[model samples]
Target: MRRIYQLALLIFSIGMLTACGDDDKPTPKPNPPVEEKEPMPDPISEFIWNGLDVYYLWEADVDALQLKSGTEEWKKYLNGYGSEYEELFESLLYIKPDANGSATVDRWSWFIYDWVEQENAFAGISKSFGYEYRLSKYSDSDGVYGYVTYVVPNSPAAEAGVKRGDIFVSVNETDLDVSNYRDLLYGNDSYDLGLADLDVENNIIIPNDNIVTISAIELTENPILLAKTLDINGTKVGYMAYNSFTGTDEFNLALNDSIGRLKNEGATELVLDLRYNGGGSTYTALILASMIDGNHVGEVFNKRKYNDMLQNYYTDKYGESFLEEYFTEKIENWDGEQLASINSLGLSRVFVLTSDWTASASELIINGLRPYMDVVLIGTQTHGKYTFSITVKDFLDNGEVNPKHKYAMQPIVGKSANAEDNTDYGDGFAPDYIREEWDYLGNIKPLGDPEEAFLKAALDVIAGNNPPVEDNMATRSGEQLETIFDSKELKPFGRNMYDDRIDSKFKDLTK
Candidate 1:
C-alpha cells in the first residue's frame, strides 16, 4: 500500500512538471517574413536636383520648379519621368524672360553624362582627328569652306599630311556647309576630308583630288605654342602665344620653363598673346599672374562671391578669410613635386593680346591684375564669362559616387571679383587699342609671325605710335567673302572654370 501510494504521488509530480513545461513553452507566434524595400530609382536626378538647388548661383531665380522636400515626394516626381533627367535638368535651369515672354538665356549651366570625359576635356586632352579648323567664306559667293588652322603633333590629321594652311572643301564628298561641316568633321571618328586650294586668280577655293582619311585617337596637347624673348623697338619683351591654360604638371613645368627663359633673357616688358585661348584653369591663371608679379604674395588675388545662402554658409563655416585668395610665390605641380619659384617682370604694367575668343581664365588674368597693375588690352572684346563651376556628382552617405548613374552637373555656381570687387565685364573688356581681325576675312596669319595683325598692333602701341585709324588692312586683293556661318560655330568648347572653394573641409557642404 505504501509503495503504491509513493508511485502514484511521483507520477502525479511528473505529470505536473510535464504540464508546467508544456505551459512554459510559449505559443509559437505566427509572423510574416520581412520584405526588403526596392532601392530608389534614378538617384542621378536627385543628385542633379540637390546639386543645383544648393550650389547654383541663381538658385532663387529658378522658376517653374516646385521641388518637394520629402524623399517620397521627390522620388515620385522623379519617377513621373522615364529617367530623362537631362531634360528635367534643362527645364530646371534659371531662364531670364524678355518682355515678349521668351526665355533668352540659361546659357551657362551645362550637364555632362560622363564626368570622366568632361574631366579629360578640362585637362586639355581630347580624342578626335586632332585638328582645329575655322569655317568661313574665302571670298564673296565662294561658298563656305573649312580652314585647317591648328594640327596637333602626332595626330591622325598630322600623320595624314594635313598642314595648317590646308583647306577642306568637303567631307565624304558632301560640300562643306554650316549645317554639315561640324557634323561631318567632328561628329564621327573616321571620314574622308576633301582638300581645297586658294585660286588667287578666280578668288575661289578650288577642290583637289587629295583625300585625307582620318581616325580619331586620344591626344594630349602642349598648350605652350610659342615662347620667346624678342628684341623689338628699343625694348626687350617676352612674347608667349599660349593657346590654352591647361593646368597640368606637364603644362606647369613648361610654363615655368618659359618664364625662367624670359627671366634669363632679361625681358623688361611682357606681351601675352591670348588670341586663340578659350581658357581652362583658374589656378593656372593665378600662377601665371604670380609669375608676372611675384612681389605681392600676401595681397588679395581674387574674391569669390557665392549665392546668398552659400555665402552665408561659407562665411559661417570658414570665416571671412574664405572669400579671398592671396597671391603665392610658390606652387606645387599636379605630381606634388615642388615647382621652381615663379619669376616676375615686376613691371607697373602688362600688355595682353585679346580677341572675341579670349575668355575664362584668360579674362580672369585681365580682371584680377587690374587692382594691382595696369592691364592693357590690345584686341577686340572678350567672350565675357565671369563665372566659376565645380564637378558635382551623385554621392551617397558613404561619400562614394552613387553607382546608380554616371551623370555629372557643372553648373555656374559663383561669380568672381578682383580685390576692388569689380565683376563688370559682361559686355567684355573693351580694348584700350581695338583691332578687329574678323572683318578682314582672308587675312588669317600664323600666330607667332611679327606681321600678324594683333601682334603688330601691340608692337606699334609699345613703340609709342598713336592708335591707327580704322581701315580695312585685312582686305586682300580679292572680293570680300560672304560669310554663311556665324563665327561662334568655330569654337570647339565653351569657357570652363574650376572650383575656387579653398576650404576642403566645407567642400562637400556646398554640394
Candidate 2:
C-alpha cells in the first residue's frame, strides 16, 4: 500500500511540473512604470498669465488670456514664452494697435522687474535727488530746459541747495533736448545740473556759471508738501499742496495733523493743490475726500467695475456693497484698523489746483465731490486716468512672495466711476478757470504764496474776483513755450491709482 501511494504522489508532482513548464501558459506581467512630467521652467510667465486671466480689466478682449487654466494648451503657451516674460506680458495687454495704428486702450498697465522697488515707490520711497521739476521746450528753439518745482527737505538735491524756481538747461554739462532729456536727467544716479536763467522777455534760456552736483539716494517723500491757512479778504482759505496720495501710516498721520491744523486755524474754505500728484491709494483718496467734506458719511464715494469673471464672483460672494467705496467717519489703515477720527472740513465748496500731472485719486476727489459740493478746478486739464491697478506677484502656498524671482505686475484690473456713474474722462476734467503753470514759467511763484499763479487764481475765485475771459489767458512773450514732459512722469509708479483693498479681498483669487 505505501509503494502505491508514493507512485501516485510522484505522478501528480510530475503532471504539475509539466503544466508549469508549458510555453502556451501565460505568465503574469508587472505593471509598466509610471511616467513623470518635467516641472515648468518659467514660473514668472505662468504667474503673469494666471494673474491677467483672473484680474485683467480687458480680459475678454485678448484671445490668449481666455485659455482655460492648467490645460495643455495653456501650459504649452506658457512654456513657449520661456524667459521672454516681458514680451508675453506686452502681448497680452489690451493696448494693441488697430488697423489705423492707434492703440485702443490700457496705456498704464506695466510689469515690475523688482517688487521691492515697486512697493517702496508706492510708499513714496525712492532713490531720488529729492527734487521735482518740469521740462519745457525753448519757445524759440528745439532745446529744452527744466525748472525746479520743489525740493524735498534733507534730500541730496536739498543738500546741494536746489530750490524752487531753480532752472537747468543741461545734465552733466550735456545740453538737454527733446531727444536726450530723458536719458540725461534719469539715466544716471549722479549728474551735475548746469544752471540756467529763463529770459522771459526773449523767450530763451541763458546758461549760468553755477552748477549743482546731485546724487540719487534712498529717500521717503512726505506728500504733504505745503499746508497753510491763507486769509483772503476776510475768508479763511486753507491751501494744501498735496503731491501724492501715499496711504502709509506716516502719510496718514501727517495728513491728519495738517487737516487738524487747518481746522484749528478756522478755515472755512479749501484750495487743494494737486498739481504734481500722479495718483496713489484709493483708500487714501476716500480718506481725503471724507476730510474735505464730512457731510455724507456712509454715502457712496466711488464705484468699482471689474472684469466679468471677477464681477460675478465678487457680486455672488460679497453682494453690491463690495463694489462701492463709501465715505467713512474715521481714518483707517489697509488692515481696517481705526487710526483716528477724521478731521473733516465739512465745507460745501472746495477749490482744486490741477495740471496734466493731477490724475487718478486726484481726479477721484474732484468727481466724487462734485455731487456733494462745488469742486472748482483752477489749473490745466488732468492726466485723464480712470482705471486702478493692484500689485500682483507670484505667491507661494504660504502667502509669501515667491523668492525665486522678483517679477511683479501692476495690471489695470478695474475702472472707477462716481456715484452718478460718470467715468471715461480720457480728455481729462477741464478747469473752471484755466491757469497753466508752464505757460507762466517765467513768473512762477512759491507754492503757498498768495501771489502764486494757481493759488492766486483760486483765491481770486473764492473772493468773487473771477477774471474776464481775456485776462485769464497766460501772458507770454515771443513764441509760446511747449511743455514736453513732467518730472513725475519719469517715476516708476507713473500716473497710477491703486486699490490696496484688493490684496485682502481677493487673496484667494490671486492664489
Candidate 3:
C-alpha cells in the first residue's frame, strides 16, 4: 500500500510540471511592446569673429603694409615696410592678380580732420585731445533697456570702467532695484520732482526720479521723436520731435513739408525737439543744417570707410537700397543739395531741443552751422560718440549645412567726423549746462541735464532777438493740425462734430 501511494505522488508531480511548461510556451504576452527612442538634433556650422565678411568699414588708417600686394611697385612699397594683407585689399579693389595702382576710392574718401591736424598722423582722427570721460547711451542686447552708458576716456573708467565681459548694473531710482529706470524720466510738458530719502540697507533712494515713475518711461521703443505743436503767446511756435536720421525719404519729406507749412502759417520761431535723436546719415545732417545755417555750411567732413558705398547693402536678414528706391532717386548731396533745397522755406536759425541722444549727426548740425550762422547749442553735453565707426555685422558658419550653428559678429572698421576739424571727442560732446532736473519721482526731466539746458538757452536766445516778438505759435493757421486734416484723404473725419470744430479753426489755410 505504501509503494502504491509513492507512485501516485510521483505521477502527480510530473503532471504539475508539464502544466507549468505548457503555460510558459503560450505567446509570452508580447513583452509589453518596446518603446522607440528619438533621434538627436543635427549639428550645423558656426560663424566666428575672425572671418572674411566685412562689407562696411570706416576708411582705415592702414599703413602701406595693408596695401603691399598691388603691383611690383606696390609690393616694393609694402615689402619696404614689411607687410602682408595685399590679397584682401585687392579683393576690395576688384583687381586681378597682376593689377597695380588704380584704386579709385580716394575721390570719395572724406577728409578725416580739419586743416589743423597732422596728415595721416593717425588713420582718420580730425583732432587729438585728452578727456577724463565720455558719456554714452546704447540699447541692451535685446534692446529693451537703453543704458545711460558712460565711459571714462583716459581715467580708470576709461581704462577700467566696465570691461567688455561685465554686464552693467541696470537700476531705476524710483523703484531703485527694478529695471527700466527711464520710467522716472518721460513726462507731459510740465514736470517737477523733489529729492527723495535714501535707504541704508539696500542703499537705494525712496522717491526717485519722478519721470521714471511715469508709465511714459520705456526703453524698448524705437525712441524716435514724436511731434507736438504748441501755442506760445501770439507767435506760431512749431514743435517737432526729431529722433534718428535713419528714416527714409518719406520721413524727411514729411518733416520738411511740416517745416514749410509752419513757416507759411506765420510761425515766427520753430522749436526742434531732438531729445531722442541718436544721429544718423550725413545727408540727414546736411538737410537739417541747411535750415539752421544762413549759408552753405561745411559742418563736418567724415572719412567713410569702404569707398564703394552702394546706398544700402543686401544680406539674407537686412536689405538696403529699399530706402533709396522709395523715398529718393539717390542720396542727396550733404554740402550743396540738401542745404540749398531746404533753405527755400524762408526761415532763420531754428531752435533745436537736444539731449544725450543728440549725437554724431546732431553734433554735425551744431558744428557745421556755426560756420554759416549763429547756432546756439543749448543743451547738456552731447553724446561723446564723436568718433564715428563703421561696423559690419555678418553670420559665420561652422563649414556645415544647418543654420543654427551660425553666429552674428560685428567689427568696428572705420571712423567719422563733421566738416569741422574736430573729431576725437572720445568722452562725449559737452553740454553747455549740466544741471539735473527731475519730475515727481526724481526721474530727470527735459531729457536729462543736456536737454533742459538746451531748451532754456534756445528760448532765451529767441526771446532776446531784435524784434522781441511775442509767442505766436498758437495762431498759426496754415501749419495748424486743424488744417492738416483738411486733406481729401483725411476729410472723412469731418463727418463727426469734432471735424466741424477743427475745420472752422483751420479751413482758411492760405491766410
Which candidate has the top score in TM-score?
2
Residues 64-138 of candidate 2: C-alpha lDDT, one tens digit per residue: 887777776777777777789888898899978878999669989998899899989989988899999988876
CA lDDT of every candidate = 0.73, 0.86, 0.35
Q: Is candidate 1 or candidate 3 better by lDDT?
A: 1
lDDT of 1 by residue, 1-511 (tens): 9999999999999988888795587788989888654346465666777777778888878753345534565656666665787877776777856679994445667887887777787777777676776677544444568666567778898899987657778888888765666677667879898987766555556798999999988778778877887778768878888878887767877897898799889887888988778777777888888888877888988788887888998899789888877777766765446776776667667889887778878888999999888888887788788877777777677777668667888777788799899988777788887776544434557666677677777677777886663434445553443335433233334666666333222236743
Q: How many clashes does each candidate structure show, in the order listed?
A: 2, 0, 55
Candidate order, TM-score descending: 2, 1, 3
Candidate 3 regions exceeding 4 Å error are: 1-175, 178-236, 297-348, 389-410, 438-454, 465-511
TM-score, cand. 2 vs. native: 0.89
* Weakest ten-residue segment in model 2 by summed lDDT: 467-476
Displacement of residue 286 (Cα, Å) in model 1 is 0.9
Flag the better candidate by TM-score, 2 or 3: 2
- Please give the lDDT score at residue 199 for candidate 2: 80
RMSD of 2: 6.6
Per-residue alpha-carbon lDDT of model 3 for 110-209, expressed as tens digits? Answer: 2111212211111112111111111112222222212222222342222323221112222232221223323422223122222234233443334433
